[model samples]
Target: DQQVKQNSPSLSVQEGRISILNCDYTNSMFDYFLWYKKYPAEGPTFLISISSIKDKNEDGRFTVFLNKSAKHLSLHIVPSQPGDSAVYFCAALARGYTGNQFYFGTGTSLTVIP
Candidate 1:
């Protein structure tokens, strides 16, 4: 099932500006905790994240906020740069019948214009 979705497939932002990415999940049971960034021909890397118990988490220029009531989450990048251009994925940890499972959004491709 497609529990998570990124409505915007792509986003373009000017360098030194702010970039925001949004994601929504259908399953309320999902315990969202991570955002990932993927570059060309590389593995996805952990970005910023918010635990289910907390509404927001920040790391360097990245921040992730969660709205559990609305099943929505977002990632914010300040002063976006060309190197920041990549595919971003929002993921959640779902405690399934068997064990802990991860659900990921389709991903949103970001373009930062220098």
Candidate 2:
């Protein structure tokens, strides 16, 4: 079974509105969470991340919240822009996994409209 999962396959939002993406994980040992964005014909780029110790982490327009008890996390993009439209992926890794292994969710396609 997949350790990480993104329930939503696609979502749309106004350019200036907020875009919310969600993910769930089954492993409690995952101590790090990351959100990545990918565009066509390009590799994924890291958007933001949070450690298990933190309940929330935020960047300029992106924020990630983790609920350890529920094994869920969500990413919020405020003041969304056209450039923010891309496929978003949720990934998790254990605190000290040596193989550099990451459990990744399928991905959520986000469309930001003007």
Candidate 3:
């Protein structure tokens, strides 16, 4: 089974609203978490991240929250804009078969409408 997952395949929001994306992980050993945004025909771009020790991390209009005990995390985009529409992926770094590696969730596609 995948260590990380994004239950929601897609989401839509109005241009000036808040967009919320959720993610979950099964590994308790994960210490670092990151959110990446991807656009068509290009690689995923790093957005923001938070350490497991921190509950919340924010950058401009983006924020990430983590619940260690629950092994859950969420990304919030405030005042969503049309340019923000894209595939958002959540990733976690944890011990792996050989060494530490990053595991990524499937992804959540967000659409900002006017």
Question: Candidates' lDDT values, in order?
Answer: 0.92, 0.96, 0.97
For candidate 2, list the clashing residue pairs, or say none: none
lDDT of 1 by residue, 49-97 (tens): 7878889988899999899999999999998999999999999888978
TM-score of each: 0.95, 0.96, 0.96
Q: Rank the candidates by lDDT, best first.
A: 3, 2, 1
Candidate 3 local Cα displacement, residue 72, angstroms = 0.6
- Position 102, candidate 2: lDDT: 88
The residue pairs in collision within model 3 are none
Candidate 3 local lDDT, 48-84, one digit each (tens): 9999889999999999999999999999999999999
Tell me the alpha-carbon RMSD of every candidate.
1.0, 1.1, 1.3
Superposed by TM-score, candidate 2 places the C-alpha of residue 35 at a distance from the truth, in angstroms, of 0.5
- The residue-by-residue lDDT of candidate 2 on 49-111, one tens digit each, is 999999999999999999999999999999999999999999998655366578899999999
